[model samples]
Target: MGDIALTTLGQDIMARLDEAARFSEPGPGVTRFFLTPEHRQVADLVRRWMEEAGLAVHMDAAGTVVGRLEGPAPDAPTLIVGSHVDTVREGGKYDGMLGVVMPIVCAQEIRRSGTALPYALEIVAFGDEEGARFPTTLIGSRALSGLFDPATLDLADRAGVTLGQAFADFGLDPAGIPALKRDPEKTLGYVEVHIEQGPVLEAEDLPVGVVTAITGIERHTVAFTGKASHAGTTPMETRRDALAGAAQAIAAVERIARETDDLVGTVGSILMEPNVINVIPARCELGVELRSPERGIRETARRTVLESCEEIARARGLGFEHTLGYEEDGAACSPRIVAALKEAVEADGYRPRELFSGAGHDGLAMSALTDIGMLFVRCRDGLSHHPDEHIAEEDADAGARVLLSFLTRFGTPRP
Candidate 1:
């Protein structure tokens, strides 16, 4: 691609990203949740763009915005490409937005070139990959993959509104959710373009790379209970402090993660009863997350952390309880799809690096239904889920070109 074309495409992607940011919570940064007004507005905007690109578009009952371009044959298999559109609290603009926008841009280019593939192209802007509103992630993709359970419809948000109610309020029928599942026999595969969201790509001096796998994730909420007492009167040796037990568990998680290879554990959130300075905490609740590309190692790390927490609770004479919030196994990309992406990257004059995604993505959920692939665009300092996350324009263009190249060559008959 020439500099002019690349520049134009980059500018367009950035413009659309900025436009999406406008629908966020009324604050200094972006925050769009599932079934919220901001999410609906952004979905509408993306739907319009898909329409402008000659795609047949609709918002599914799960709130996923889907745009389809029919192949030459009516019953041909479909190739799905997309990423989530929802953002975390005070999120960056490009994390999920770029994946949705770039695919549309590629579709436009395909149309301009008058090229038709053997399979239909469907671009999806998923509604809830972040799970920022509800406790569950991948709600949209799960529905499309036929994994959505009716019971999940009763999941409540901070406002105590049921997910089913939100669906109704958004003009969608929860009863019709099953109709949204795609037929596996008619689907070829799925592809997602997302920011690297880590330092590996930038450190390697590469603009784009092919993902080998997405890390498995296990989330837990752990609570330690003990008697509250006066902070000044309670002696260190005599006190049973829940916060102290939780603090020890947190430190153990950090230690275990560092000692284990390819494993990571985080205690991202915590709450304590009797948070006042003059009182010993009676209860402490913490959010524990464990991740790794290898499922065995990930599970082992999770067990190790739980055991450590148990040990701490026992030593401190506190009651311990934990509940699993979410668990997803690591997903490997299809080797066939990875080869095609690598060829496209090399064709564009960039050496391809294979890396595992540390952060979770909608692709993790889609993998249950189809062979999935991912292309990672380098981001500045590997920052994501924050207001400061950044990606260079040229890097964005490179990702777009590689995706277009892959789409152009995929599933074509070998001459």
Candidate 2:
């Protein structure tokens, strides 16, 4: 595509992104979760765009909206491209939206050129990747990979609605989820385009990069229990405060993360029983999360953090409990797809840089089903999941050009 054409396509993508932002809930920033009314509206809009691009569109039982453009041969394997459409509460506009919009624009541009590749192309707008509404992430892609647990159907949201009930409310049959699974034999690979949620690309002064692997994640809920005491009457040395133990644990998490290379841990949430200025808390609940690119290192960090929490509680004379909530192994990009992405980036007149993704993406789950590759577009200050997240039109254009280049040259079958 010519520079002028690329510019026009970039503008179109931005316009569509703005349109999708309108479907968000009432807030200072965007917030659209799984199977909600906002999700349905976004799905309908994407389906229309897919149709206009001359691709056949369908919504699977998992609420994934897929747009298919068949290859010349009917039995040829397919190359899937897409990202999640769901957003975190008060999230930025470009995080997942760019991935979905850029691919649709690529497909439309390819169709206009009247060219067909050896493999079919499919664009998927995943229904739930944030897990903002529910507690589980990658619900859409995991279902496609046949990794979704049936027990999750019974999981309920804050509104007391089960996932199965949510599916029914959305006019989808939960029993049909099995049929949505893709055959690995028939899939070439999965490619995702997304904004770099960190500052590395910007620091390197690069607009695009190839992702090497996604970080592994482990989450837990920790509780510290202690006897309540009068805040004014209790002597400082005699107090066995649950909140004090929790504060030490939180500090330990930060200290560990800072000491370990490529390891990041967070104590994102904390709750205290009898949360008052005048009362010493009887109990404290905390949410702990750890992520690292290396599985062994991540596990070690988790263990260390848990051990520190226990020590803090024991020293403070408080009871402690740690319960594992969720875990996902880090996923490495396929070497074959990585080579293709590097070539695409080089062909686009920029030196290809390889980096690890700090945040989780649909590609992490899809890697179990097919080889996965990711193209990262630089965002301002490496910021994402916030209203301030941003990407320049030139950067978006560069990303689209790379995707077009990759599609044009990718012809080898999955071995």
Candidate 3:
């Protein structure tokens, strides 16, 4: 098949992105969190678009919106395309929305060109991927994969509203969450289209990126406890300062990450107790995320950080504790899907390279029980999750074309 005409695809993609960006509009950014009114509105907008594209749409019990395009042969497993719609606080428009919209655009293009695939195509917009408002990630996909449990309902937001309560407020039944499981035999494969969220593709000047694997993520909360001292009374050498110890540990973690190849450690969030200028900090809390394409490297870096924390705490006469934040089982992309995408990218007159995704995605959860792959469009300035995050319109269209080409080869015969 010929490459998708950029003029048509670009206009459509831009329009959709613009529309989705208007939902939360929290200051110059977006903030459509789980089960919030803005999120519901955006989801509703997605459903309307799905129907407008002539796909049959339905919402599963767990609140994932699935849009289906039937193929000539009815007896076949479905090729799934999706990403989350939830955005982090003051996030960008394209981060997770592109993953869902690209599939829709592909379906529309295939319909326009009269292209037929062997299997039915299903586009899913997963809810609550960022977990910004709640503690659950991949809630929609996990529920479909039978991973969401009764305890998931107990998770509350800052306002103390439970996930189940949010579901109720959204006019969905809380008890029906577990019924969201899909027929395992019917899902043939999965694909996610997203912005690179890094400088990789932009640096390479590539049109699209074929993801080889999703990075393993290890998140932890490190707490350092030391004596609170009067700033004026305690000598600099005599003070047992928790904040000082935490700063040293954070510095060590950053240095270790820099030394380790392909490993990333972010100590983005920190809290100091008893905000007083005079006292030596009694306790300091830090949230850290460690990521690496290789599990060994990630594990080594993580272990080193914990060990360093213990050493620093002991040296400073402090108490230390580590709590796991979020641990996603690492997912390597499906070779078959990646091969298909690479071929498609080549067919579109672009070179293909194998790259690992540094960020966690909903695809990681879906990959547990289904074959999955991801496509990354170049991000301007190698940035994402910010209001300034961007991808060229042509790149958006090209990524969709790559996804269409791959989905054209996806799925297996229902037996």
Candidate 4:
């Protein structure tokens, strides 16, 4: 693609994204959630775009929209590219929507140019990634990965409507969800184009980067219990204050992260008893989360942090306990796909940069279905899930051209 054509392609994609943003509820920012009327309209609009691009389109039982383009050869494994279409409470336009439109435009260009491909192509727009509607997230992609738990259908939204009911309202059968999983033998791999959602690419002055891995995450709760006493009566040297022990643990958490490389630990929430300032706090509960691309590093950091907390509690004469709430193992990008994406970016006349994804994405769930690869375009100031989130037109052009080149040269299987 020429420079002028690339700009035009980017402009078209941005315009489409702007159109999608219009379906949001009346609010400060985009607030479209899964199973809402807004989601239905947006899915229809995306399906229309896919049809216009000369692909067969359908909305799966999970409300995920997919478009298919067949290759010349029969029985060839299909190449899959996609991202989620659902948004957070006030998400920006480029977060998940960009990935969907980028490939649609590229597939349209390939159709117009009559280009040949080594395999079939499928573009997917996943629904329900943000968990904006229900207590669960990633329902669409997880279903594709055979990770969807059927019990989640019993879960209800704020309106008390069950997921199964929502499916019925959308004219889909809940029983069909299990069949949405694609066979690995007939699939090539999955590719996603997403905003960096962080400052790494912008700081490095690169428009795009190859995703090395989606960082694994572990969350645990730490609670300390001590005898409550009158603040005025308790002496500083004699009191066993749980809040004081928790304070030390929180500080250690920060220091632990600062001392470690590529590791982030956060104590996002704290709840302590004895609301009155006149009384010493008897118990304190904290929510801690740790993330890192390397499992061993993350696990080690987690153990050290927890052990430090326990030691602080023992020193303060407080009962200490912790429980691992949830854990998701990290998913490394396929070496083959990573090399191809890096090569694609290098072909676009810039240095290829590699980084790990700090945020969760559909790619993490889809990794179970097939080999996964991701390309990240830089967002301004690392802002995402906010109205101010943005990417430059030139950056979009770079991402588009790189992806265009990637799809064009993906590979040919031997007869």
Candidate 5:
């Protein structure tokens, strides 16, 4: 098999992507979260694909599916390729699914091309990358990285169902979580192919983005409290409007983020207590997410934002409180993986640009414990997490080819 064979593999991978896209709402967008029926259905489909590719398969108690091409030496380290299959609310068809399917396509191509690799190849499709239902992130990758703990199992969704319950409902055993942790010593490296979910590649007219670092994320839930009073009765000077104080704090967060080159802060969600039209808000709750490639910048911006909010609350005679939410440490790709991607891109005749992710991912979690790398494909109009999010089929296919080439080089170990 040669370059033409790779084009055939690309077409096959895209066909699978389209099939998965059809499983959910086709045009409007796809929505599949962890432990949901859609999630299970997709997982089953991926497993069948793995079987067709002639790989041994298994799903850990945490619901991560692994398809293994045994290495000649069973004890030798393994090269793992995977990304989550779950989608965010009204998410695009390609975001996480590309990462999941690309490895399978590559595995099939490797088998056909008779490429020999030094290490074993394991294709994985993680369960929950979106965390749309649980309000937590990277559940599947965290389990593999040994970062998951009892507390994680006890975490409840918005519906008040524990993660254990969700696992149980999905026909997985929650008590066997200890077995889910992958031994870092047995792992060679990890690679993932995913849509950029941003506009960097499109803006640069590049088809592929080799990730430099996964941005650090800091999440905070802030609450502002004040006396609830009639809007008309509260005098302009004496009134302690919680919403007013929150607005000022939100503005401060934006200012701090804009002060740095890579820092970004967003107050995307907010709620006003006792939301009566004529009443001054008694309390206001807002969620702030700050991200930066540099940890120092992230910490500094978060601290500055918190301090500014406190000051605003004190001056305005309101009570201010904030609690730290989820955090993902930034990860820089392994030099070996980066170089390989560069070679693969050039070999495939596509220009490559170094990029950083503003959002967190399963790869970020895996990066904590092992050598992990990521690739980003372009998204249409830079939109994501919305029904209108999209990616061109040709671009998606291009990403798969680059990924398949990288995986072919990594080659699976025969068990």
Candidate 6:
């Protein structure tokens, strides 16, 4: 097949993405999560696609759907390509699903042409990258990476269902997750194609770019406690308003993040008790998240924000508390994989642009298992995690073609 095949391939992959979007919950946009009916339906669809590509397919203990293309040697090391299948609330059609569908089409093309690969090829679609249901993220990838902390299974969701019970309800044994871990020695590498989720590529007039590194992320749940009283009865000088203290702390978070280079902080979720015009708020709870490519910069910003929050609480005579929810350190892309992707982009008639990723990805978890690489396709308006997320059809074609080029040339010595 020549370059013309890529356009047809992109159309095929886009249709599959649209089909997968149908399984989402009854909402404004896609709202699928792990261990739910939507997950089951999408898993079945993915299974059929992989099967059509002439690959053996299976769903792992953590609900990760895996497709395998055996090479000449059964025991030979394998090249892994995949991304998460889960989506956040009101998510778009191409966040995680795009990465999965494009590879399936490439696998289909590989099989159709009878191309020979030196190593076995495996395509995976992780079940829970969004963690929209479980309050935890990267369950499937972390489990496969052998870095899963089993205690996460004990954590509960909004409906109070634990991850372990949900696994059981879906007919999967949580005990088997440990067995799903891949051996580092026999694994060649992992490659993922995803949306840029930023405007750099579009601003530069590029369809795709190579990833240099992913930003590390840390999140904390903070709460402030104070006395509850009637707003009319509580005087401004005597009232210990928890909400007021929380508001001050939120501003501090923003200020600190801006002061530190490349550091971003946000307080997206917030709650207050007796949230009415006539009553003084007695408690306030919020989620504070911070991210940066450099761990030292992220850590320093986190320390400053935490201290300032506590100080504000003390001044307002409100009790303060916080708990660390999740953290994943930043990781650099493999040099070998980056070089191969760069060449692949050039081979496909596009200039390769390398940039640091401000967003987190499944590759962060996979880094613990084997080498990792990423190809970022331009998205419309740099929007993600919303219903408006989009990418051009030609851009999708570019991403898939580059991925195919990278796969065919990788795992061999380059001239």
Q: Each candidate's lDDT (Cα)?
A: 0.90, 0.91, 0.85, 0.90, 0.83, 0.90
Supply the TM-score for candidate 4.
0.96
Name the lDDT value of residue 188 in candidate 2.
94
lDDT of 4 by residue, 1-415 (tens): 2343555778878888899999898887788888889999899999999998899999999999999999777887889998988899888999899999999989988988899888899999998888889999989898888888999999999999999999899888879989988899988899999999999999999999999999999999999998899889889988989998999999999999889988889999999997578888899999999999899989899989988998999899999999999999889999999999998898889899999999988888889989999999999999999988899888887899899999988874424
Best by lDDT: 2
- Candidate 2 lDDT over 1-415, as tens digits, reads 2444555777788888888999999997789999999999999999998998899999999999999999879998999999989999999889898999999999998998987788999999999999999878798898889988878999999999999999999999978887778999999999999999999999999999999889998999999998798999999998989998999999999999999988899999999998988999999999999998789989899889989998998889999998999988899999988999999999999989999898889998899999999999999998888988899888888999999999988975546
Model 2: CA > 4 A from native = 1-7, 222-245, 272-285, 309-321, 413-415
lDDT of 1 by residue, 280-374 (tens): 99999999999998999988888889899999999899999999998879999999899989989999999989988998898887888999999
C-alpha positional error of residue 237 in candidate 5 after TM-score superposition, expressed in Å: 4.9
Tell me which of candidates 3 and 6 scores higher on lDDT. 6
Q: Candidate 5 on 115-157: residue-level lDDT in tens? A: 7667888888888888788867687788788877767777888
Q: Over the stretch 1-415, how does candidate 6's per-residue lDDT look in tens digits? A: 2343454877777778889999999987799989999999999999998998899999999899999999768898998999988899889999999999999989888888888888899999999998799878888889889988889999988999999899999999989989989999999988888999999999999999999788999999999998899889778999999999999989999899888877889998999997988888999998999988789988898889889989999999999999999887998899999999999999999999998789989899999999999999999999999998998888888898899998888877657
* TM-scores, all models, native as reference: 0.86, 0.87, 0.87, 0.96, 0.86, 0.84
Q: What is the C-alpha RMSD of each candidate to the true structure, in Å?
A: 3.4, 3.3, 3.6, 2.1, 3.9, 3.7
Candidate 6 yields a Cα-based lDDT of: 0.90
Residue 230, candidate 6: alpha-carbon lDDT: 86
Model 5 steric clash total = 11
Q: Which RMSD does model 3 reach against the true structure? A: 3.6
Worst 10 residues of 6 by lDDT: 1-10
Give candidate 5's whole-model lDDT: 0.83
